[model samples]
Target: MAYDPNNIFAKILRGEVPSKKVHEDEHTLAFHDINPLTPSHILVIPKGPYVSFDDFSEKASDAEIAAFTRAIGKVARDHGLAGDGYRILANIGENAHQEVPHLHVHIFGGKRLGRMLPKE
Candidate 1:
């Protein structure tokens, strides 16, 4: 899928939309989720315009990949979620119900999260 500059995350990156930013660096941005599922729900995203994890991992530069990965860790630690552990997840494609076109990873923590998914 082609990258959409008009996507919500793209808008947030461009400062066209408001976000409760937690951390930001040259290659990545971390922010609080508007509709948080946990006490510390954050979203980490790359600065580049990528459609999903597949798109990002396949196209992003080494520096971008490293920075994006580190940003997620930093955000979790900074938010005090590291001690209790956290869940990092990314939804890819339509079947995964990816709401935004831009690639983003959700960091969920702050309480004991049960199983990732119900048993099939």
Candidate 2:
């Protein structure tokens, strides 16, 4: 699906909505998840209008993609999860239950947050 210019993340980028920011650089933005699943749960996103991870990889410049990934690492370290480790997740398409059309990465840690999906 095409990127929705009016999606919530777009609004956050436009400053139309408020978010507790964690980190941001020229090509990316990181913020706290409003409905956080863990103490250090955060959301990372590219500044551009890419609908999913695949879309971001295909359309965004190499520099932008690098910056996005770097930002994620920095945020994890800033939250003190680098040593212990952290979880980064990106949900794409409907089967993954991606609620938002805009592309985003979820960084979760700071505790024993476990089992995103049930054991098979």
Candidate 3:
């Protein structure tokens, strides 16, 4: 998909939109999700323009992805989600229901997060 520069996350990154900031560094930003699934749900994204994991992987540098994942871990640890085990999710493409095209990782925990997927 063609990257839309005006996507919400992009706006959030550019400070055009406000968000409950969680963790931010030179490479990534983490913020509270508007529609949280768990008690402590946060969204992490790279500072660069990336539409999806595929986009990120193909275009981003190793250092960029490293910073992004480290930002995720930091957000998890800072929010006290690391101790009890939290979930990190990245929804890709239309079938996965990725609303915003910008690449992002969802981190959530604090309650008993149920099964990850439906049992077949």
Query: Pick by TM-score: which candidate is best?
Result: 1
User: What is the total number of backbone clashes in candidate 1?
Assistant: 0
Candidate 1: segments with Cα more than 4 A from true spot: none
- Top-lDDT structure, candidate number: 1
Count of clashes, each model: 0, 0, 0
Ranking by lDDT: 1, 2, 3
Better of 1 and 3 by TM-score: 1
**15-114: candidate 3 lDDT, tens digit per residue:** 8999999888888999999999889999999999999998999999999989998998888999998899999999998899989989999998998888
Between candidates 1 and 3, the lDDT winner: 1
| Model 1 C-alpha lDDT versus the unseen true structure | 0.94
For candidate 1, write residues 1-120 as lDDT tens digits: 678899999999999999999999999999999999999999999999999988898999999999999999899999999998999999998898888899999999999999988999
Model 2, span 33-97: residue lDDT tens = 99988888999999999999888889999999999999999999999999998899999999998
Question: What ranges in model 2 sit over 4 Å off?
Answer: none
- The TM-score values for the models, in the order shown, are 0.97, 0.95, 0.96
TM-score of 2: 0.95
